[model samples]
Target: MNYTLLNSIIVIYVGLIAYLGYLGYKHTNSTKDYLVAGGEINPFIMALSYGAAFISTSAIIGFGGAAGAFGMGLLWLTFFTIFVGIFIAFVFFGKRTRQMGQNLEATTFPDLLGKRYDSNLIRAFSSLIIFVFMPLYAGAVLIGAARFLETGLGISYITALIVFTAIITVYVTTGGLKGVMYADAFQGSIMFLGMAFLIIYTYVQLGGFTNAHVLLTDMVHLVPAKLQAIGHQGWTSMPKFGSALWWVVISTLVLGVGIGTLAQPQLAVKFMTVKSNKSLNRATLIGGIFIFSMTGVAFVVGALSNAYFFKNFGKTALEMVGGNFDKVIPLFIKTCMPEWFAYIFMLTLIAAAISTLSSLFHVMGASIGKDLYESMITKDNRGSQKQSMFLIRTGIVAGILLSLLLGYILPISIIARATAMFFGIAAATFLPMFMLGIYWKGVTRIGAISGMFTGALSSIFWLVFIHKKEAVALGISQAIFGKPFLIETFPWMVVDPIIVALPLSLAVTIAVSFFTGNTAIQPPHLKKCFEGIG
Candidate 1:
């Protein structure tokens, strides 16, 4: 609403980010510095940076918008992230990953996994997956930020998309992970504080916490006939089980992201940035609080935006935004909240977006440069810095352009759905291989490769042929099978790709590993990976 104030804030924030980027550029000497922050970072900064990168605009704008449109059942996602994403990740995965990475002298996630499996093809396959799908995830975040900017600043969506991407292009290219972490710490703080205010103020506006839910519950009769047919319940209650709506919420939204977080390359890579086990333990406490303030608040507020909109303007959130779920949170903030809070919230969104985009692009660059180009293309597995830097920046620029393009063409209310799809894809492609590669010596190169391919191929096959939401949009099944999806049944059509593909990946990996256990790697190498850590 206030361009002059907003523009001023933008300048200051960009100036700080630039300075941090320069600091990172100055500190980044070796490839290790650029990729993993020289293997030492503050626990607080690492935790906050990890949380900030993990949340993104997808959590706030996209998922929050979903909450507003659908209801509060998404709260289960918050619980999952805390338990699985934060706790299981740190206690079970993070400690081992850090030591294994240090032992392998790995620079990126693909490098870590590939070295553990003693297979360059494993690295190439994993890196290819990241390079392919990470941009799509980044695109979802890209569009989420642009949507908010277009709505809050009253600009066209295309203009918002370009301007935001343009700002990110200059700095992320120069700044290494150290700079990214510093900027993330700063941005994550704003997000946490802004969201803290957001939840409190929203509740205060809608008759406190208890009354807010009551207001929403009382309006359950207002559900449209179309929604009720598919199990639309009140905001306070979960959808009726076995319904399409129930499957989407649980299978796609909650489980897809919640489980997928464990195997995310961007998040996994951060664990290696910390030097010791204690740092990760400290990080767990800070990370849990940060995640709650971001996703938990966004979902609760998004669900309750319905109550707010109805009481004030006699329309549901979907009605107010003309059925565009992505615009719900932005529209609500601009219309309902105080002008000053809008400024903070906008900064919060910008921070969340940039914090995430920078990391995603950086990870893309590393995935391509270190994992694919160096390991696969070069015989020595590492070429000159000039060549390496060239490809890394090339990956960054390419990913940025692709994400910007997706931001333009993606359909309305596609943010959260797109995010879940990316997460699920990541889960299917890498989760089984990655998890077993670290934890089990019984895992073989053949098993890891088989699992990765099976999971990735099967997941894509299911998404294109069976998953109702993505299949109908892609329409490949329509042309070949003469149907939008190959399956027209009840729950089978609605079940997530991760549910089926992940289990297949696990079973295939284990079955193959059992047969190939005698062909395992040298004991000394295996000992190196498991040394001095659980």
Candidate 2:
């Protein structure tokens, strides 16, 4: 097993992370520094950090497993991740977000929105949403890494989850955003190298790309009966367009996380970490390469793993991993890749999980303590940076525990579902107001509030009542109404909430703003927010 080599790699990685945390701690003199790295981080660090945080174990393990079962249809998500998530995010949203954050002196995403609209309620509500729902996403990230540890190293899931969370919480709570970003940059580099090797090695192992694709395509007859019934065509092609598989892949996986990336609090806050628009522009290529390598490799390897498994073991990747999609990639690496590469790839997964977890914890803590507590719970503490920072750190610990608990409670193969849920809900809730508030000056405070609340609630309602995953998992609909899901119509069960909720949110914002008609005055700070970045 080369225990010494594995141990040494892990130890060195941990040491490097600790050193970054120390650097963050040494530099974090004020609350602003703790929150946004004093808004002075270099472009390279911000780009790598953002990309790393955006593609976590959820992408590598969760969505990778999804590709295993669903085939290359998940590649659409990779395209969205690069074009919308990285390209548009950095070029369009990043410039305005940084301008607004610096102009408004906003430390958090909620702070930016709240201050721009001059509404504490908006700030508090946004924070509450983040605190409440982000754990689901965080839990997905935790479970992905935990599965890797459990499968690759023979560690118990519970122990892996706890150890992973503890390490991340320590650095994030102490070093704050600085530590999170620095660690993320380092982790992102490891991910880039690991994934590049993974894709190349996978192809070499399964013959060339053309040969592998042909083999996978020809193996369509080998797909499980259940998957075939659900419209799976083959490993190298998209599913049947109108099938249930297509609906889940397109509505939930593709549109959900793809569009949802725009409103992500953790990623959005990264825009505020640096000072100039040029920094964001410079980051685009770096971010594009990082995302493409990470997501592109994950989907390719995941789909191809099936062909590998079938060739060697007469089974698909999902069958080999016992139908738990989240376990597919971990099992693949452990059973297939060389010993040294397997160990290195395990560390890559760790880096992916920890980087994302650190950002989620930091954002959640800031939302709770900085926005919720200071702004709403105790307005008198608004000026107390030390007290607020303490509270935020406390919130970080609490968020970690909550996510760990969720990781334990959730069912298997729930990682991608949970990830989509969080992303969809976040997009539904915040995307309208966030994009409108930045681009459209006509967005009123009332409209923003109403839109966010309406969108957020509708997303929840859809998840509980219509979305089959939560409908079946939670059993609320069944308990109350004697059915697994409240909706009994075609495509309703398969349709994602984002398709409905996001439009409703956008409509409400536009309708409410038009009706209000100059009644709501823009804040003075907003004008500064719109000013071109110096």
Candidate 3:
């Protein structure tokens, strides 16, 4: 792996990151500056920062490996990520969130919703949810990067986990959101250039774009027996509808993360950093391009690695990695690309990891330090600035520790699954109320509370007892009922929890809001919420 060259690269990358973090520290002068960059971040930097935070090693390594195994069907996720995650989020959600956040003087996401609904319970509970579960997503990202270092650098996975965690904890804690965004912009640029080069190099290796996919379609028979029974039609074609594979690909991988992007506290908070609706509008194109380059190239290159492996090694990508798809992309790069290119690509993955990890830790810190601590401990929504920063720093450290622990504890091939699990939970718990809170004048405090609890509890219930994948692994249902899942039926067992929980949440929010009426929020406060909307 060329230790001398690798060490040189690490020094350069870490140096750049330190400089950016210092820049972020200098820019942060207050709670607002630390949290949202004082709401004056440039559109280009915001777009890149958001895109970088959104696409981490989880997308490049975990989902990319899934593409190697699942085929081009993952492209649908790329489409949704670009369209719904960026377009709808910015056009429909961003403009309003920025204005409302500016109006309410909200810093954190929990604060944004809590202030909007005028309920401390909403703020506190939302803070707890983000603080608790965001680590799972952070852990998934950590695992992806740790595995890459383990594969590429021959470093121990635990060493990678601890070292990277420490670096990012300091980076985020000292620099705040400004530091995170500045570093993210740098990372995002590397990700773009690396991925752009990868796709071009990949197509040349596998003949041409047309021939590469044709070869994959023809290798349908190469799919294993276990996969064949489950619905392995072909790499190029969709999984057979209603099959287990189809359910997993559609519900968990595609819909779970794709739709879940909207309510992400880390990403949503980025919208509040921009100054105007026009910035959000302009950001859409840049963000779309960034996401497309990151995810699109990843899935495409991953799917094509199978062809390259089969032609030379006479095995599929999954088989080459000994059935651990998490190792697929790293192994492919190590074997196929030039040594110089391989080292460069490793930075791309590292950047993805640092960008997302820093953001996750930042959001987790705010959830606890700013939202939960202020609402629960201080009793005033506004707490001492010095004390709040102290708690936030503590939260970032604790979040990093928990995330690193999970990175070590989780099983292989868990990168994509862990990520989707957090996304699905976040979607079910927050999205219904979030969507209504920002858009609907009639949404009441009680309704928001009811909907939020229902979504959160129901999603947990489904995971613990109903969703076969989670239920079996978690063993909660097995311990209680002597069955892995409550229903072992074909479709029910495979369905993602968000599919059921989100609708129930939305239904309850709407019904409860009408039952409570617009009087739930006082006229003046409600008027303040929608003040500038036409």
The clash count for each model shown is 1, 0, 0
Score every model by TM-score: 0.98, 0.98, 0.98
After superposition, the stretches of candidate 2 with alpha carbons farther than 4 Å from their true spots are 377-380, 519-525
What's the lDDT for all of these models? 0.89, 0.91, 0.90
Could you give me the TM-score of model 1 versus the true structure?
0.98
**Clashing residue pairs, candidate 2?**
none
Error at 214, model 1, angstroms:
0.8
Which ten-residue region of model 1 has the weakest summed lDDT?
Answer: 374-383
- Evaluated against the true structure, the overall lDDT of model 1 is 0.89
At residue 409, candidate 1 shows an lDDT of 86
> How would the candidate models be sorted by lDDT, starting from the highest?
2, 3, 1
Candidate 1 local Cα displacement, residue 510, angstroms: 0.6
Q: What range of 10 consecutive residues in model 2 has the weakest lDDT sum?
A: 374-383
RMSD of each: 1.4, 1.5, 1.3
